[model samples]
Target: MPLSLPERPIILTGDRPTGPLHLGHYVGSLRNRVALQSTHQQFLLLADAQALTDHMHDPAKVSRSILEIATDYLAVGIDPDSTTICLQSHLPALADLTLLYANVVTVARLERNPTIKDEIQARGFGRDIPAGFLCYPVAQAADITAFKATIVPVGEDQAPLIEQTNEIVRRINRQAGADVLPEAQALIPSVGRLPGIDGKAKMSKSQGNTIPLSATEDQIRDAVRRMFTDPLHIRAADPGRIEGNVVFTYLDAFDDDHAVVADLKDRYVSGGLGDSVVKKRLEDVLQAVVAPIRARRAALAHDPGHILEVIRRGTERARAITDTTQRDVRRALGLFTLH
Candidate 1:
């Protein structure tokens, strides 16, 4: 089911333009983001600057993927008319706000962020973690406060980033003797993570287990055909394990026919159905699921200029709010030089 945000709060969420979005993004956020636009003032940031925080050495890759990322957002149901989609770099206010937020936060505090710790371990950036990577939480605080966003939808791994934003919000509000920024709240997803096709931890681009949103029909078919299944269930008569099985995970995510899925589960557990048969069903389900999305994406791909116009208009609206927030922040910091 798509997520719902409470009335009376602004929502801000976005993806870093490090790569094209994939199936995991659909399950995690994009699906709900599409639905939320009708009900709330949603800001979808194409966080190119944030991508550069880690991809400084690969500017070309970052530059190329921003268009791909925006395409993915449009392919899904993110209507630019209802949702404001903007480039992160276009908002110069975010960088200005980040500078002020950094002073309010301590170095020790930044180092202890759980998300940063995990990213550092995964990327093998021991002591050489970029200063930008370490200070990203402050940048994120600027992202939230720049738009006065009160609700931030994030996965569990991103909860620390939201907390960091709220901390700055409280600190800045108190320090200036004015409640200029509202404390941003983290709406953590109830489901923890989506496993990769390899049945490993989270689905990731570096892990080579993602099904790209822009993937062709043949590519999706081949990927699903190669999906991991229950290793212990070697023969048709062997009882299959449902828990931690990739096929069942996909079914839980995509298949709306719970009764049919239950029947398949029973067949597998009762030592009659083979793993091949179950895999075939999973393949069918996945194909049925993504076919319409692929078709819609193809239709939109025919008009690249139209897509860019949507983003251009969205960027303007986004800049309007950010411009006001930057003015207020400068006033608070005495950066404004008005006579």
Candidate 2:
């Protein structure tokens, strides 16, 4: 039988369990997830399997970071009651679905994926890209379709993955003459990239430019102090440029008072506003945001067993849903008799 669509849209989104979550995650997707949980049937995945595509050599790191990532989620107010938080590896059906979908997509199509291309270049994998890494998009398609997620929240860089996922869905539906998989739409957040303290375009842990959610006041202060600003503005009276200023960018994203931020920007562009003053304001704003989260994470860290229980429960619930999808997929492909 063909799978039926849900009355309320299902949202599927998650993070790779490589390390602790950071400000980039908060501005990009974490805030949106907290807000959308009430309105949609949401499933948040801890994509350890996806993380392994790149970190295959460090299996222990991936294993150890699973609970840490889950703690970050809970710390940021992702209620387990409202959101089903599932680990990717726990759901065997996703792998089965990936295997089935692999034959439908061509190598040329995978190579054309803009996100994959960018990642390959960023990782400097000139010609030695792992087959597993190359095929992760197909697995991601399985992740979305298995849950029948209508909305998949992602960054701008990942928009192409959603497109490729829908293409596979359409191809399979046309070939099987059944809507075995539902297409997912990408929910790209407005505040996409949070520039690193070093003024890099993106903040990543590997780049040594992330402010983790659990950072202390001292750490936050240190990061803000070293934030990149206009090099030309050596003197306090020198006119500054805000175009590529990472400090101002952080203010624009984090500071709630629009009028205050606008006034600061005016002063910054005109001169007389020192980088220290701006950095102080940024530090204050960031502390206000990260303080509560840090407190929550610290409190949660004391009860590792409870966090593990949450993952176990969510995995059980998610497996039931994916199991049904797998059974339907098997029937559609005539792998087994539909009893």
Candidate 3:
């Protein structure tokens, strides 16, 4: 079996295992991955190899997070027995694929990648950016093509990354005079990207603005209490602006009470509703949303060994599929017998 795939197409998606997943992950992709598991052949990667591209000095952080990442996946209802949840480094084929892909792609193309540019600037790499960090998009292409992925679900900001993968696919197929590597399409999520508590564009772990998946109840409450709201909304009776409000944004993502959210927006926008009331509503929404996941994660935390076993078995299965693809890829490039 080529994993559980839909009659339509196969789906491939994953995250770098640099840290535990959070609410942003849940609202962004994890929930969708859970739904896709029964319909599409899904490969959920623990991208430690990719993590090393940036976290080269911190193997210990990556090591601790590997199992935490797995537990988050399980708690969020990713059926590991059905979907392949494996480490990126375990699949040797991906490394080989990356080497071949690197040759076809130029440094100029890598430099122009919007994602890499922002990453390099954010990391404050003055002139000495790591070669691995620069070449990671190619590695991601290898990750996708290693399993012959047809569909990759990602956020809107990642559209350029998928485009790079498609370019590599087309170039490799042209050079080989055959379509061995299928062009992968992106499935952009419908929701707007979640902002950090400070209203930053993204809720990143590094920015110290993320709510951890394993955060304690007190931590969650504190985070909520300090969540940034519209600066204009100072007094309870003041006419608050809801257009760029972070609390309303959280409510949009987490609160199931659409009518209530609508009412709150109107009241706040018009006048007399305080930010505290909206914040309290958001707290209720988040707590209701995360309670079960927290409970599930707590239960699984007791069986760390079992979780590792699941990851090991999934890695074994993923390698089998990637191996076949690698062999074919090498043959296409006339490198199988040579190396």
Give the top-scoring candidate (lDDT).
2
**lDDT of every predicted structure (CA atoms):** 0.84, 0.92, 0.88
| Superposed model 1: Cα runs more than 4 Å off | 1-8, 333-335
* Model 1, span 1-339: residue lDDT tens: 122334656999999888878888888888888888888889999899999889999988888877777888887888888888898998888888899789999989998999988998989999998999999999999999998898899998899999888888888877777777778888776555788988998899879999888777788778877788888888899998899888888888777899999999999898889877877887787777677777878888788787778778888899889988888867775675463
Model 1 lowest lDDT segment of ten? 1-10
Candidate 3 ranges with C-alpha deviation above 4 Å:
1-8
Sort by TM-score, top down from the best: 2, 3, 1
TM-score of each: 0.94, 0.97, 0.96
The number of clashing residue pairs in model 2 is 0
Backbone clashes in model 3, listed as residue pairs: none
Write candidate 3's Cα lDDT for 4-31 as tens digits. 3337577889888888888889899999
Best by the TM-score measure:
2
lDDT of 2 by residue, 184-248 (tens): 89988877599899999899989999999999999999999989999999998998999999998
Q: Give the C-alpha miss distance for residue 324 in model 1, angstroms.
A: 0.6
